[model samples]
Target: MPRSLAARIVQDPSDGFRHLPHLHTQAPDLHVSFDVLGGGRIRARMAGPAVPALRGTEHKADLGARPDEVHGASARLCARWKERFVDFQPVDDQGRALRDRQRPFATVADLTAAPEHELRAVVADLVRGGASLLFDTLLRGDDVQTAVFRSYLRSALSQQGLRIRFDSDLHLPWPMLCVAADPSAGKASLDTLFARFLGHRHQIEHTGDAYAWIGTPRTTQSQPVVSLNHDVRVGRTTKADAVAKVLADGTLCTVRTTYEELIRDFEQPHLDEQLMYFWCHGEFVGNAPEPPVLAIRLTDGTPFDGHTVRELRADYRHSSFRPLVLLNACYAGLAGASADRSFLSRMLIEHGAQGVLGPLIAMPQAFAAEYALEFITRYLRADANAGRITHDLARHFAAQYRNPLAFTYGLHGGMDAQLERANGGEA
Candidate 1:
């Protein structure tokens, strides 16, 4: 009684409708399609009767019909298709289709319906195979209500490792590179949260611009230039004591140097530390004269946005403490042409950083602080006697905050053991 996927797509060909590959429908007039674009990305398009044009317009139909009607129908149709086709088969390392026998849908669904740990394994397998699932939901409500529901749907799908891309002529398409992290609604101070989470007094450095620090020190041996508003004397005392205590507790001690300090230190080669932690504001410039500079904040609250991946590769190609860099900035993952790794994580790993952890979306200050504190706590407090502890720590952090659109976590290094350990021996 229901039209086939392809037929539904053909009936309501919205703008750029010819691009998708699979289509299905529950009703004759309504339909949805699954389009496999390049880069292993997939999109869904849903269409039905065109709404009537506004007063004095040419098109004629029921403008009174809500947009959700179309969207809801599409979602229902796609969910059924996913239920029908959601089986698993083995594939090669390259994600190429292999000759493995297809398993039963009930088994896969049962796995998904299992506990979170089991569901994660199944989802990881799907991602590793370069396959993305899509759901097209039709809505019958005001545009505003529809938008709210769409956001909810996006959040739901992202938790399942699926990114939601909405298509509609009524609204402008969301930016391709932009991902939204839900902010903690209200007037909560991120600074206070950071202090509570870290269990220590900290300073806030607000640099107006973004930049990368090249050949910088991991920690500052000199006294920090404390802000005046937050009781400079007390802050300095807290920082000094915290630094000494952390170092005394067998944690590695490193200094965060300013651009000038880094330049001078690099020339003299004085400090001797293997691992480093860089905490600063950063920005990703895609089409700049020098692409993808990790902007570091200076002591005077100024941003020094200079230094490229190429320069780092050429200069610190062999530095022992090339220092794994974690960029706490927006769009830090997107890299430019000519660079094998554009994302800050990949760039840092290639440029000598042992590992990196950063958000793939615009991170809210509170979330960033929380995530950073957790990572540092794990790294500093966890026993390092085991193999690949750091990598596992990073993966665990990512899994906990897995939101494909609002937040994507990535890791790159030569340490396969670390990655595997992080995966918890699953997948």
Candidate 2:
């Protein structure tokens, strides 16, 4: 798939000899494209495949309605999460658990664990309410919007093991958004409620327009090349060590210790890495009045944000430079507005990265480490695409260990991202 993909692009950056391995960028089974209209309104058009009723025809549906002020629905949800969990009940400096609170902490195993149930309920409410915000705010004039979205999701329920992607300008959490049925579809049972979350039910991907392109491959690679860019101070942490071990075992590992070093490396014309993993801190930095821009730190604490990448990789348009990026930092995965400056997700994607996966909030390092190990291990050794792998992980953590941190990680494009053989097939 990687080599064949290289054949499609008009420009080639490699020397006449080497090939660059491509990430999976296949089309989805169903896609919904959302565009922001003025006044928090959003317009949607379902592209490619049609709803079940309209499938198998030569018709292409452009479903649109008067959009509403969903302007910062995703932003609001993120804020709510931090306020509920972070400010009120926050993680310790090590990201262990809620800061020492007198309210009595409890794990899932404790029969009288109010905190566990409370957290679960909070997550559920956030998801469903987010769904309501997205679903309701998406098409607001009449029953038209509801009908269109519900019909789209209902048809989706029938398709097994395929991803359903959402594209938009809003920075909303696609995975956390809930799915609703029309009053007529009947009330869902408790056992079947897991399907309510778009992330759990489907291999969901939400990205900006032009989120992907054909990724190329390097024929010379014995094992994929991986780079670990982390803060200098976090070297001794379990999370950092766990990730380093994974990279060491599966691929050729290169380490970047500081923000200056990462930017300096990006300045180089060629970045041969197939996977770029950043185990650092993501911050929202800015002046007093201006909204804080998202930036990252690498022990040295210098701000490394998207602006640097956009400036450095602006010329990557024809480079065939595609690497699956994992930002295990806070606020890196929270969806953002369409304004052009300092969007970590958009900056990387617009510059030819295949996929960008990261946490939507300040994730505790404990769960983040486990999630990264599972994701990276599968990505390196299994044939599953990133989206399917994400879905499976969500289920795995929720069921096996009773952890919900998996859903906090968001995927931008690269749903079809899986290892590919030189012959253009699944590796």
Candidate 3:
């Protein structure tokens, strides 16, 4: 018997690549055209001449006699057919060859006004066929790009019966954000302070050069200590061991896993509750036919791409324990607003996480880890008899750096509220 389409559509958790065929080959009739725009105008161009003919006359004559050479020369002769021909021949679709010549504004306008249904059909076919398509557009600015991308994503995902939810409206407990990156790097500093202000009620897990608990100052009398010295590993197999070690030492756990294990663990119905802290470095490509994945380091010293935040959202709704996900990776929370869709943090809340905290700016790796640990330690272990733990945490860190940039924290949902209440205050 043949395998079901659903079975074929699902990717293997271990490898993370989809089991579908190439999108182009699968949809031979699909046609796509590019329009390079600058200052709100189109740019017309063409292909260059073929490689210089073979040196020897006899060899050139033999090559010229070949049908391919003849066809190549003929194609070059026609201005409209100068470039490489594909399913969407400019001449066939636009009635003009995209040659090395300038065209009037009307011509460009006519091409843009052409039936977009065909283009939509091509995109739909690629998605349904299970092939990932990357739509990389250089927009005017971050805000503009984000808006356009979000709109396009909504239109695309809605066709596939998926929706992006917002975190604030969901009212779930705010999740603890953890970072495990290189310390020398400043990427994780804000994250560390945020964790601390949350009352040091979280955990800091790392596999860097040293193994010691960097504790917060208990009182003005006692100094913060770093006493434990141990070897820490960063990949998947050691993730569980690291968590176990942290728990044994009576500290909160922030475990880092291989990209493959991250996906596998998310998909599994049962998850370890004690493993509360989650962090990783991965790519999040939205609206692609292939699932978005977190690129993680493997046990064999190779890198693997795991599933997207969407896949994780689905798993969270169906799983037993939905761990709060702190995606230190770039573009993780980049889902923009369009119709009813929200960002990745919102998706996590809808599925199962209490809440998610990530950065809006590109973070440096080492700094990200250090700040994350510091924040987690302070929040999980600090005195929070005062009110507004989450807000205070954010504020405290902001003050320490004495820079507004240091307080760049975006929160989604009630997880922030939960943390505040848990720390003995109201939000």
lDDT of 2 by residue, 60-104 (tens): 223343322454665677676656534444356786666455222
- How many clashes show up per model? 28, 16, 38
TM-score of each: 0.36, 0.78, 0.35
Off by over 4 Å in 1: 1-249, 266-274, 286-294, 301-316, 334-347, 382-407, 414-427
lDDT of 3: 0.31
Candidate 2's TM-score reads: 0.78
Please name the candidate that would achieve the greatest lDDT relative to the true structure.
2
| Location of the lowest summed lDDT over 10 successive residues in candidate 2 | 102-111
lDDT of each: 0.32, 0.65, 0.31
- By lDDT: ranked, best first: 2, 1, 3
Candidate 3 deviant stretches above 4 angstroms: 1-248, 251-256, 272-279, 284-319, 335-343, 382-389, 416-427
Per-residue error (Å), model 1, residue 202: 33
Predicted model with the maximum TM-score:
2
lDDT measured at residue 331 in model 3 versus the true structure, 0 to 100: 33
Give one digit per residue, the lDDT tens place, for model 1 in 1-427: 9876753355544634532212211121222233334542333343333222234532111222333343333233223223322433445689775554343322221222233432344333323221111212222235554454444433332332121222222211111111222233122232222112100111101011112223332332222111110111222322333433443344334444465554444443333333344444555443565444444454533444334444434455444344444454543432222122234454445444544444433343434444444444444443431113433333343344331221232332212111112223311
Error of 1 at 261 (Å): 2.5
| Model 2 clashes, total count | 16
